[model samples]
Target chain A: MAENLQDKAHELAKALRESDEFQALQALHEEVEEDDVASRMLSNFRKVQLDLQDKQMQGEQPTEEEISQAQKQFEMVQQHDVISRLMEEEQRMSTVIGDMNKIITEPLESLYGTPEDEQNQ
Target chain B: MAENLQDKAHELAKALRESDEFQALQALHEEVEEDDVASRMLSNFRKVQLDLQDKQMQGEQPTEEEISQAQKQFEMVQQHDVISRLMEEEQRMSTVIGDMNKIITEPLESLYGTPEDEQNQ
Candidate 1:
């Protein structure tokens, strides 16, 4: 509950925002959004992702056809110049967040033990 | 990607672990685990949660009766002294992580605007 811990967290966030990956991600994302063709392509890709998420939330499986459709939309978006670079940078940023999450949750993992730790027994 | 940014992230995590909320959560969690009655109650509560999660992954919703059973077990666990306190500390820790996530994703938010920001337009 220390206030400084929260402040440190925010500072790390600011540093990440200033990182090259984040800067590129923001710039490319903006460029894609501003381009009519790229925006439509990205919009289509986002629609498929949201549709799958909605179905999962409703406790329904996405159909095989639906999955294939989504894959096609993803590939189409990836063909865009700015969209492709944005996705690459997005992956890098996601990795940063994932790493942060693992580190942040280490205390909980130590208390309960990881699922991987259980499997080794 | 700055190495310092990642190093800073790990440092923030270390700070969080050293915080009072995390310390209390860990101690209480272990105390609950070592108590036979509390352990068993917690086990039952966890089992229901895992079962519901499994069902959801398989695209099946929990029935009303199943939901009621899970709720009953949750209430029962809350009746325990250490369990209740542990849950309270867990909430606090979760809030810390949630706040971190919001801050960490600010760059993305700036790029795309928040979902709330979109709704207001």
Candidate 2:
């Protein structure tokens, strides 16, 4: 039964890959990667973002200035055509993946309840 | 590029499905399904859970008794071997899916900035 479920999961993965959302996201990623300027900008943005995340995870809030600087940089990156389109595609792909996850976890929801249940109790 | 990214996502999904965690989850799901008592209990639990979730989504808090009743029912369900195993498997599978989602969204993270950025600003 486990093996069979594994097979089903694999099948679901295949279907997800074949989805238009994934295809669009992949295409946009490639387009962004090919552009040196956009690629460089994205890398820098990610570095700052990760740093901020690490700080937050450690219970440190980013300074106001740091937050402002990050937001400005983000907006600058979004100004790029390839970057903007890639972001859109990424969002679509995320939604698709989220839906898939919901389906996969439906059985579990039955057994243990949901986050709301935990919170309500 | 989109096609390639899709391929990578598919590969990640395949790896996830084949993982020990996923196999365990799949095995437990089958085990629960095969037991009539456990299966019926799960079905009822899910219906109640969904209703609760719907109400919460509408900004309604369940009454104290409702919350207590649901918790009691959940605990009863958990006492069953198949149900408990299934719950454990579900958590494991959810973790795997979460990790996969993180990986899949990493590129997007690099592009649009993190959620913390939005919150900070």
User: lDDT per model, in order?
Assistant: 0.84, 0.71
> What is candidate 1's lDDT per residue for A11-86, written digit by digit as tens?
8888888888888887887798689999888888888899899998876889999999999888887787788888
Model 2: per-residue Cα lDDT at residue B38: 90
How high is the lDDT of residue B111 in model 2?
Answer: 44
The estimated TM-scores of all candidates read 0.85, 0.54
Best by DockQ: 1
Model 2, DockQ value?
0.07
The reply for model 1, stretches above 4 Å from the true place, is A59-72, B61-71
C-alpha lDDT (0 to 100) for residue B5 of candidate 2: 40
**Model 2 TM-score (2 dp):** 0.54
Question: What shift in Å separates residue B26 of candidate 1 from its native position after superposition?
Answer: 1.5
Clashing pairs for predicted structure model 2, backbone only: A26-B1, A26-B2, A27-B2
Give the DockQ-based CAPRI class for model 2.
Answer: incorrect
